[model samples]
Target chain A: MKILILGAGGMIGRKLTAALLRKGDLSGQAIQSMTLADVVKTDAPASAIPLHTVAADLSAPGVAAELIAERPDVVFHLAAIVSGEAEADFEKGYRINLDGTRELFEAVRRVHGADGYRPRVVFTSSVAVFGQPLPPVVPETQVLAPLSSYGTQKAIGELLLADYSRRGFMDGIGIRLPTIVIRPGQPNKAASGFFSGILREPLAGLPATLPVGDDVRHWFASPRRAVEFVLRAAEVDTSGLGVRRTLDMPGLSATVGEAIEALRRAAGDEAVALIRREPDPAVQRIIESWPEAFDPQRARALGFEADASFDEIIRRHLEDEAPATTVRS
Target chain B: MKILILGAGGMIGRKLTAALLRKGDLSGQAIQSMTLADVVKTDAPASAIPLHTVAADLSAPGVAAELIAERPDVVFHLAAIVSGEAEADFEKGYRINLDGTRELFEAVRRVHGADGYRPRVVFTSSVAVFGQPLPPVVPETQVLAPLSSYGTQKAIGELLLADYSRRGFMDGIGIRLPTIVIRPGQPNKAASGFFSGILREPLAGLPATLPVGDDVRHWFASPRRAVEFVLRAAEVDTSGLGVRRTLDMPGLSATVGEAIEALRRAAGDEAVALIRREPDPAVQRIIESWPEAFDPQRARALGFEADASFDEIIRRHLEDEAPATTVRS
Candidate 1:
């Protein structure tokens, strides 16, 4: 089976591509070809399977059509500007996140319109779609009340996906991923990045500053689990989706204090001590506006899973990065 | 008080202007100016208020700025293409509904940026913004999952309004109006128009056809009530409206049979007999997709009232149109 991954240069995108490359079988279909595309040229893995890299700006009118000409059986779309950048530059955010996604959907529709080519589309949406006046644990039934332009754009994308899928242009699944913890890389412009950075940097023996109070709880999942959700979503029988469109993915709920405790247990006390407590009210206000937890019953029923505990999450991160190490707290 | 009414040619727009003009007391503020705009120049009421008519399409760039430059204290933005038209022409729908609203909001923000000139922006949203997987009665808390482009565009407008208002750029309120039953005009492209046409045409001594089944239920408010809702929204204290931006206006819920019975009670069995029953399954599917009723508790508490029953609604329409009616069959 051939698969195409957009935004393959990003952290989750890169990990997802690697996981797909490593997998010998996906839903009983032997993995054959993989194509990766982003604004920057994506690096190919040293694998026996054929891999194609395409660097193209999807916001350009005809780029979507050109990309869809390949006609892969599955399309993983993860391209979007970070929340901070999106909020700062409204025009660019809509241009890329909204219009770009629309163009891509149109490309697939046009291809299907020509000779009935329908591909499974897995769109990585975000929890940003849900904003203030939120219940403690948001359900799939919660209405999208996005305060930020990024969230609004993502919500709009979900609408497009639902309409397109209903019209038989393509089978689509929108996965509203929780904030990914232990994100393995330099921090991006996303305001939520600090949530991961506080834990990740401290574990790496670097001083990391916590922007909010220790009591600020948030919903999160490991990067590995997030990629798994996307892949499983692509393979699952979507007939049960039944016009609801997006599904909130299963995740773990933890406060900054809990995360620190996990870090102390998994990495050493020294690593935990590296975390500096610095509360910025501006960041705290933004963090406070976010949903503290989610009731992903539908996603769980559909077989999406997350880390059993914060320790397991941190352990997985260490194991993935430094496989030879056996650190004792 | 100067008033700028976008979509001045529309049903509620014409009625609202007439109502305002008829009111002798406007809180000691006389109607000094009226700027009317639509795709076509509206034939406004004959009043001493200096009237300026513009046939300028709001979708065109720079038009919103021009409209805002008129400096109307009260801006009634009711401009939009209907659902059927929006669904048919996706680009035009977004252009007018989404981009046009954004441009207008930005224009207000720009004007307010230099010297805080906040005008009261009253946007007319619709129940089309709510789609299927709805509860028996949708509450204020229910998530907006619009199945149509028109719905998505309107929801986007609501988001924009809330953000702009929260930022103190402009004072705005979005009222999700129920389907205006017994709309005093010819049938338009709206799928829900048949609800009004079946009653209005019959009352006017013309043959009216029912497109859907008697079992189909929908929310209803008279055009008079709709105007009142808009006016109330404009002058009402909006400090109570928190981040959950839009409010679903209170309305009566009735089936086709119920509506016909009310029509018969108001305009005699002769008018009721003018109704022809013809089931269009295509239209039925569309009607079925809509929510049967809404629990507009928030709107009720905010002082918006509705017809007691379909009977009251029909009576109101008859009283407004044919006041001297003496026979009840």
Candidate 2:
């Protein structure tokens, strides 16, 4: 099977690439080749499988068609500008997040129109699609009234995916991932960056700033689990998804206090003390309007799973990031 | 206040034009001028108010910009291809319904950017945004999972309208109109045309076909009430609407059997016998997935009223279509 991964330079993309390489096959189908495309240049991973890496902006005219010229069997579309960046750059967000995805879908449709080639396209959406006035555990059937521009773009993408799939233009599946906890990387400027920052920093003996109170609860799954969801979504039978093709993946729901307690259990008082509570009203106000938890009944029924607890999430971060020195020991 | 109607040639558009002319003003503002645009030429009404009609395709490049050149204070966008036509032609649907609307919004944004010109953009959405396995009375917060291509386009338009409004590009409101009953003029090939035809034809002393079973229920508002909803949506204090700008307009929900019974009462047994039960599986299958009823709590609370009963609906159809001849003693 020939596979293609867009946004292949990001952390999740890199991990997904490594995971695919380790598996060598999907559901016993032999891997023949792989193509990775991103805005920045990506180096070919060390593997016997022939790998092609390309740096291209998917939003640019003809770029998506060019990328799909080889007609890969499965395409993982994980490319997107983060919430903060998308909100700040309105034109850029609609251009890259909305128009870019449409171009890719159009490209795939043209391929099928020319020759009978139907490749599965797995799209990565975000929890940002749901905004204020959320139920404690938002049901799968709740309305999508995204307060943010980024969320609106994702919601639009989900609708497009469903319509395109229904028309038999292409095989498409959208998975709305929860906030990814313990993201293994250097913290950027995202408001939700603190969710991962406090954990990743303290695990490495670095102090991290806390912008919100401990009572701030959120829905989250580990980056590792997120990648798993994407892979599973690609292979799952979607005949039962009905007209609504998007699925909200299950995730661990916990408060900041619970996460702090979990960190203490893993690395003792030292790691817990490293988190400095510096309140910022701006961040608190933004997080306050976000969905706290989700029922995700549809995803669970479809065999998707979430982390058991915040403790498990912290432990997974240690195992994936720095396995040489165990946090507990 | 100056006004612009994008689909001035359609039935509801003609009624709205008459309604506006009757009122002679919107709120307390005086009507200075009006621009009516449609795919075909629109005849000027015999109103004292200055009226200009433009015949052009809004989807064509530069057409939207040209339409906005005069900068009408209130823009009523009620233009779209019907469900049957949209389903048969996918590209045209997306082009006219989706891209055309986006271009309109973009044009409005550019107008705002150039100067301090903010217009009230009242967009017409449809209950087709909701699909099957629906609740008895769908609530305001129900998710949009349109089964048809037309519904998909309308849903997309709603999302864009909300996003544009949120960004302060234009003051906007999207009213998800119920299926318009007793639609005037010659019958076209719409699947839902039977809903109106079953009543309209008999009133005109002609035979009509019933493609679906009598037990099939659906939501509806008369062309008059729909026009009222649009006018109300235009003037209401939208400060309470927040970011979720679209609203489900209240309407009468009755079974096809109930509608027929009302027809019997209005026109007696002789007119009722004019009905022919001709089951078309294709039409039945399509109507089966449509929404039956709606709670419309939000709209009711905001002062929107539904027709009291099917009797009132039938009487209104008669009054609006032919007031000189009485159907009942």
Q: What residue runs in model 1 are displaced by over 4 Å at the alpha carbon?
A: A24-33, A187-191, A211-214, B24-29, B106-118, B167-169, B187-190, B205-216, B269-285, B326-329
Clash pairs, candidate 2, are B1-B30
What overall lDDT, based on C-alpha atoms, would model 2 receive against the true structure?
Answer: 0.89
Q: Per-residue lDDT of B245-277 in model 1, one digit per residue for the tens?
A: 679999988899899888887778898898888
Each candidate: how many clashes?
1, 1
lDDT of each: 0.84, 0.89
**TM-scores of chain A across candidates:** 0.97, 0.98
lDDT string for model 2 (A1-329, tens) is 99999999988899989989998987579889999999887997899888899997889999999988889989999989878888998889999999999899888888888997788889999888876678888887888889888999999899999988989887889999999999887998888999999988998999999999999999999989998999898888888988889998999989999999998998889998999999999999999888888888888888999999988999888888866475776
Provide a comma-separated list of chain B TM-scores, one per candidate: 0.94, 0.97
DockQ of each: 0.53, 0.78
Q: Estimate the TM-score of every prediction.
A: 0.90, 0.98
